[model samples]
Target: MKLVFVHDGPIFEDKDGQYYEYSYHGLYERYKYLADEITFIMRVYPVEKDTKGTKLPAEIKVINVPNFKSPSSYFLKKRIAEKNIEKQIRETDYAVLRESSCAKIALKYCKKYNKPYIYECVGCIWDGLWNHSLLGKLMAPSSFIIEKKIIKNAPYVYYVTDQFLQRRYPTKGKSIGCSNVVIDKVDESVLKKRLDKISGYHVDNKIKIGTAAALDVRYKGQEYVIKAIKKLVEQGYDLEYYLAGGNRKQSTFLKDLAVSLGVEKRVIFCGSLDAAEMPHFYDSLDIYIQPSKQEGLPRSVIEAMSRGCPVLGTKIAGIPELIEQKCLFKKGSVSAVTNSIVYILHSDLEKISIYNFQKAKKYTKEILADRRRHFYDQFLEEYRY
Candidate 1:
């Protein structure tokens, strides 16, 4: 049977016809295991394929809708995008509406065609808007209402962040809490290298703390991480902070903040790193922090955990579900974050690293794939078109 996936991300095809999607290639991997053929319906805009972007799988077919890249042209093109989405829904056997504002068009077509669809709830856009701009805040109430309606209408639901999204938007449908954070098996040599680093940990040595995210986004709390490090530094702590992801444009604001705080020398902005190179980056860290003000579930934090790095994050969204309670603190509290870091470092590095790695195993591709397959089977068994 054919599965149609709907979301708001834009994918670009390069000169070589290589598919490049930023932060959203995991969708291709997720559906590849569950369906014979898959159609991804999204807002696609073209870009010159430099050697940089990730390639999409061949088994998947892409249906491009209006990306609405130009603000002035949005409304006119959006109507056309709706038509394209309707045509695809008419052809596909089943639909998977990955929750995004873009899916409203697909939702309309699904209802009109009497098509069976499942809603995959990843996060709450309303709560997430606090990190975004004024436009997002102004649009949040309606977005929340529309999201609630969309999920309520679906015959089945799958949630990535179990507690937060499910609690806020309860639905009367078959539901499963399977996170989309997929990781391959951690290399044995990498795990051994992590152990060696911890074994040599000493009190006076410089500590390397790192976090990964698109830093330009205010809510990722890259600034707060720098502040937390500054607080620790004033108290006679010798540590350095490394920020991964985001380009020079995104780092401009953050870099200025580091300079003002006089921690510019201590903060290292490593720009963007590819997925393959991440494990080594995680291995270099003594402590990994994800100090975001909001999230569904953070894939980067889990990546660090899989690499046997001790993790600390703010108590927000689905973070508490991933790591121990002691590893979390009040959201946006610089002191609480500083205190948690100090506590984790003093408590037990080796023990926490072991616990984290073991916990990360549950999120491996093999384990999560089985869960996703079971969910798909149950849905197909219950509601077949």
Candidate 2:
């Protein structure tokens, strides 16, 4: 059987012809179980060097399509993109469409040709676009309506969040909630080490708080955390805010904000760390915060939890699903974030760490892989006949 996986990707090909994407490593291996051959239908971009992304295997075929920059550009190229997408859909035995403009276009062809397809609903288009900028906010309502309709009518659906996305975009067909985050293992020793670190915490010692997210996206809400850090510093708490992730331009913007807030010395930007280095990074933090204005069950939060780090996040999207109510604060509210940080500092750190470590075990690779396999198996069984 053949599978055509369509997404809004600008998957990179380096000078040596190696394919790369930030999160696509080992993905083709997982999908191979359901199909003999797989073709990826998305946008492709050429890069001079590898960008620290997962190198894709050479066997997978990539069909490049136009990447629209704006509404006008999209309208100009829509017909051409649809023609290519339709041709690919007709040629493949099965289809998988991730939520994007390309997916929306592909959906029309899927229904027209009576092809079997599944929708991989990841994030809320409305929240994503609305929080992006003024133009995105203007376009969000109609985009949400269209995506909701597409997801509702999909024959099979898979969501990353346990509850949030399903509620926002309900499907009448078969559906399953399985987070893409797959932890390698949950070690008791790691939790014990975290507990020891927590026990060593003293009021006089400088508290280190950190967030792992790209600096480019303003909606990630790192600025709010910076504001909260300023307030806390004024309250006489010695705090160091570490932000991990890269984007030089946005990093400069954040640095300027810190300087203006008079907390430049307290803010530390630890440029992007390698995947292997993240566990140690999480361990070094006194507290981890995901003060995002938007998210689709953030993998960084789960990663921090796996290391038994006490975590706080905004009450939005799938964040509430991962964090307890007491640890959650209102998104975009500096006061709420400040108060939550204070609460975590005053509360029993060991108990919170234990709870997070136990909660993270639910997303271990061995467990989630089985759930995903079962879902794919069922999908194949129904569609193959």
Candidate 3:
């Protein structure tokens, strides 16, 4: 079977020369084992012109989604490009795909050509833009109409969480269940080196509360963790926080927030590290805190658990379904989030470690990959009509 994946996730450039968006690292790792021939059609933006992917597993194709931005021509050039890509899809069997942005073009072609495709929805874009102030009253209804039309057209739509399933999207066709594809193990040598570097930074017998996420705290709930960190400090606990993320500007804003709380020196902002830096950061921490009210099964929490760092997260969306522990707080409750962190910090590490270790294995890449292979095979067969 010829398997093709289309995604708009961030690209990864490591010391090794691999090329593709590494967001679904676990999924792709598993794809290595499952796909006989895999092609990843991605939007390689201007920023990634010089960068390549990690030292990825073999037998994969990195095909760039054609660019279509000419200010004088408005969207005419982009429209032409989309039409070309759509025609290409019409001529071939593109198995798996993400239903966002330009994939709509390919999806239209797939339907016209009677080719099978899977629509993967990580989140509702309309909800996302609204949450981030990118959505307006006019855009809301338009966004709804657009999403409704595209979703209804899909033969199969997959979501990383249940939010999209229990609501709109997959209005027709098979609404396949989903899971977050993160936490494929990294090179232990690279993992150890990253941790050793972090260890040399600062540690003074304080309970280390660590988090690595995109710097947007409003949606990410990193801000809530900051506020909770402040409360913890007030309670006479020596709190040391290491927040790592991609945006350097967010690091500056968080530093300011920390100063306002008088814990500026207490919070450490390790500017974005490579993908290899993730596992060690998760493992080195005493506790991992995620106060996010909005997310589709965060890879951060999964990685933290996989590395044996007890996690405290809001029981929102698919999280309560995935996390195999009592370490959850009700969404939007500041006090509850704070208390969960304290519980993990004060609890016996041994008991928590055993439970967390067993649960983390449930989200390993191998397991997720096997599930994906089954889903892809079934979807292609079921939707081929």
Candidate 4:
């Protein structure tokens, strides 16, 4: 079978003609058995000097579209992109659409061509856009309405969050909850080391707090954590903050923000780390916080949990499903973040680490792979008939 996979995320191509994507490392591998030939339809850009991502397999085909910088740019390039996407959809045997603006366009062609497709509803478009910026806020409502309608009508839908997304965008057709995050394995030693670190922690020792997310997106809420660090420092608590992910430009912007906020010394920018290096990054941290104002069952939180690092995140989307209610704080509230950190510090850190480690085991690669395969097997069976 020939499959056309569509997503709005940009893919980068190096001078050597190699393609790279930040979050798509093992994603295409899942469909290897389902599709005889796979073509990815996404925006393609030249690789930046400081950019980091997993290299794409040479066997996979890519159909590049313009990387629109804004709504106006998207509009300017819409006609040409639509013509190309329509042709691909018409030629493809099946479609797998990851929720995005580009996916919305592809869906129209899929229907027009009578192509069978599955929808991957990863995050809430409303929260994602509303929390993004002034322009995104203005686009949020209409985009939400469009995406909700898209999901509602999809014959097969897979949501990353168990209940949050399903409830918010209830579908009348067949659906299942499955996270895209796939933990290769959880080492027993990781939990033991975390427990030992927690037990050895002292009030006088500087607590290390870290978050792994792209710095370019403000909705990831790294600034809120920086504010919390400043407040905690004012209260005489020893603390250090580490931020991972982003290009050179985004890093400089954040570094400037840290300097202005008087937490430059406490905040460390680690730039972007490869997938293999992420486990070590989580291990080095005393606490992992996902301060995102928007998310769809954040992979970083689960990765952190696998390393037995105690986590704190906002009480939004699928976050509550991952951690105990006590660890959650209000989104975008610096004071609430400040209080949550203090509460976790005063609570039983060892117990939290153990709980997180055990919870992470549920998301191991073997378990999720089985679920995904079952879904795709059913999809292929239906398509074949």
Candidate 5:
């Protein structure tokens, strides 16, 4: 059977120096392993393929729909994406969507073409937006209505965040847990011994706590990390902070904050790196963190855990699921986050990091493939599609 995945854009969002988009690549990585016959109905855009260029699997197909404009004109562009998407679906056995806009279009195609479609949404976008502005809170009711409609309509509904599903709707989808949690940690090519030795770097030393995400101030909790770093410095902890991802806007703001904290030498702004090369950055960490106020199964957490890095993060949206019993604090509390980091850092975290890596095994590419295939199998068995 043929399967098609729809997305807002073909490439991830790039800020001044940091690239912050997550859901698309994470989902693509997971789904690419599961489905043999697939088509990418994406918003074609320009991107940098490494100097060596990209190598895509033969099972995947690309079909760009130019109707993708900015969020402001989504309705008009959506119609265009939907217009051609319907044509592609005529031969496909199944269609999957990443978010609400795509879900609505996929919903329509399923209704019109008599094809079975699934909503592969990660979590509640409306609630995530509520972290950024009052507008998101205002939009939540409509988002709820639309989410409910999409969930009820789909033959299969898979989510990336279990907390989101449980809080917003009943847990009745085929593969009910967080569908995929991506981390660029396990590259069999690299020597495992290098990553396995976490104690050599962090034990009673001037540790560097790192986080990789777009410099955007709102969603990423960059400010909170900086504030926590300042608090740690005040407590006489010899440490430097690595703020790896940020664009011009975010970098400028953070640079100023670092100077204001008078810890300018301690904070480093290492701009965006190619997605494939992120594993190197993950390997160098003494302590890893992401204090995001809201997240959908953070890929960074998965990556850090893969390197056997003990992650200290906020207990937000889907994050608590992966960091289950790891290290966490109340969301937005710099003091709480600082304490958690200090506690984790003082101990010999090599064994803890090993445990973290072992836990991450459950969400591997092979595991995701099995889950997706079985989800399709169960749905088909229940109703011959």
Candidate 6:
């Protein structure tokens, strides 16, 4: 079957000439497994210098729409992009739109042509705009309206996490709960290496709390972690925060904020780690924190859990569903995070680790793939009508 995937993240051909759809490459890999042909209807852009991307699979076609990195660029280039998306969708057997700003046009064309399509609900635009800049906030209302309409009218809607999305957007058709992030069983050697390192560290030693997320999105609440760490240190606890993932420029603002909060020396900004190297990073942490103000579900928290790292996340979106209520704090709350960290420091970590690891198993690639296979079988049958 030929499937059209509509989203904004651009596909790039790296210096080595390997095709990649940025972070969405893994998701596309799963698509390549199920569909004989895949057409990605997304904004296309050039890869940055000195950087590379994950290679895409063989059975894929990329339809380059106008690349709009920000909402400011949308108005000028939207029409031409929409025309291209419409033309591409016409050739595909079905469309699967991963909810994004660029999806509005493709969704319109799909309806106009009476084409069968599914909505991949992976985020909440309303919550996403809460801490975003002026442009992001301005686009929220339209995005929210468009999202609701698509969810309501689409033949099927697949939510990345059902905890918050299904509650927020009630759909008439099939609503399958699935995560796009693929989790695999960690290697025994990797787990043992992490356990050995973890065993050597004690509570009295420098405690490491880590978060793996992009720094540019400010709403990930790195500042809150800094504040909480400052408070913890003041209470005579030796705390260090390792922020993994993000660029040097993105780290600059967080570093300045850490300095202002009097926790600069304690905060370590480890720029982005490769996928294989991420296991070692997660292994080195005593605890993982997801203080994001918005999310569909955080893949980072789940990954950390898979590595037996105790997780503390804000009670928002799908986080509460993954972590226990006792381990959760309100989003952007410094005092709440401070208290949660203190609680974690005193709690039965072994028990927490076991529980988290078991919970994470539910999101493994094998289970998710089975669910997708079932969903697609029905989708293909329905598309014929």
Top TM-score hit: 4
| Number of residue pairs clashing in candidate 3, backbone atoms closer than 3 angstroms, sequence gap of 3 or more or interchain | 2
In angstroms, give how far residue 10 of model 3 lies from its true place: 3.2
lDDT of 1 at 285: 94
**TM-score, every prediction:** 0.92, 0.92, 0.78, 0.97, 0.81, 0.91
- Superposition error at 169 for model 3 (Å): 4.3
Clashing pairs in 6: none
What are the per-residue Cα lDDT tens digits for candidate 2 across 1-385? 8888899886878777777765554568767877889888888887422134556778799888888766778776777788899999988888889888788778888888888888999899999999999998999999999889888988899999999999999999889999878688799999999999998998668999999998888899999999999999889889999998764555998999999999999999987565677888999999999999988989899999999999999989998999788899999899999999989988998899999999999988889888999999888898895
Q: Model 4: which ten-residue window has the lowest total lDDT? A: 67-76
Evaluate all candidate structures by whole-model CA lDDT and list the values in order. Answer: 0.82, 0.87, 0.64, 0.89, 0.68, 0.80
Stretches of candidate 3 exceeding 4 Å from the true structure: 12-20, 26-37, 46-59, 66-77, 134-153, 162-172, 182-205, 324-326, 330-336, 380-385
The Cα error of candidate 6 at residue 89, in Å, is 1.0
**Regions of candidate 4 where Cα sits further than 4 Å from its true position:** 69-76
lDDT of 5 by residue, 232-337 (tens): 8788888888876644555887889888988889888877664566677877777788888777677788877776677877877777777755588877777787
Worst 10 residues of 1 by lDDT: 45-54
lDDT score at residue 367, model 6, on the 0-100 scale: 83
Q: Candidate 4: lDDT over CA atoms? A: 0.89
Residue ranges of candidate 2 with Cα displaced over 4 Å = 46-51
Better model by TM-score, 1 or 5? 1
What is the per-residue lDDT of model 4 for residues 1-385, given as tens digits with 9 covering 90 to 100? 7988899778889998999887776777876767888899999888888775788888789999676646778766887788888999999999989997678889999989899999998899999999988988999999888888988999999899899999999897788898889798788998888988898997668999999998988899998889889899999999999998887788787788789989999999887787888999999999999999999999999999999999999999999999999999999999999999999988898999999999999899889888888888888888864
The best-first sequence of candidates by TM-score reads 4, 2, 1, 6, 5, 3
Pairs in clash, predicted candidate 1: none
Identify the leading candidate in terms of lDDT: 4
lDDT by residue for model 6 (1-385), tens = 6778898876676556566543573666676654678887776656555334455676677777887555788666777787788787777767888888567777888888877888888889888985787877898888788778778877789998856898888788887988877788644454555556666766788899999887888889988999889889989999999998766776888899889988889999887665766778888889999999998888888888888788999989989889888899988889999999999988877778777877888888888889988987887777654
Better structure of 3 and 4 per TM-score: 4
* lDDT per residue as tens, model 1, 116-202: 888888877787775688887898898888788777767789998768888877788888888888798756666677888999997
What's the candidate order when arranged by decreasing lDDT?
A: 4, 2, 1, 6, 5, 3
lDDT string, candidate 3, 276-365, tens digits:
867667766777877766666677777776666667777765567555557888766667877887776666655565565566677766
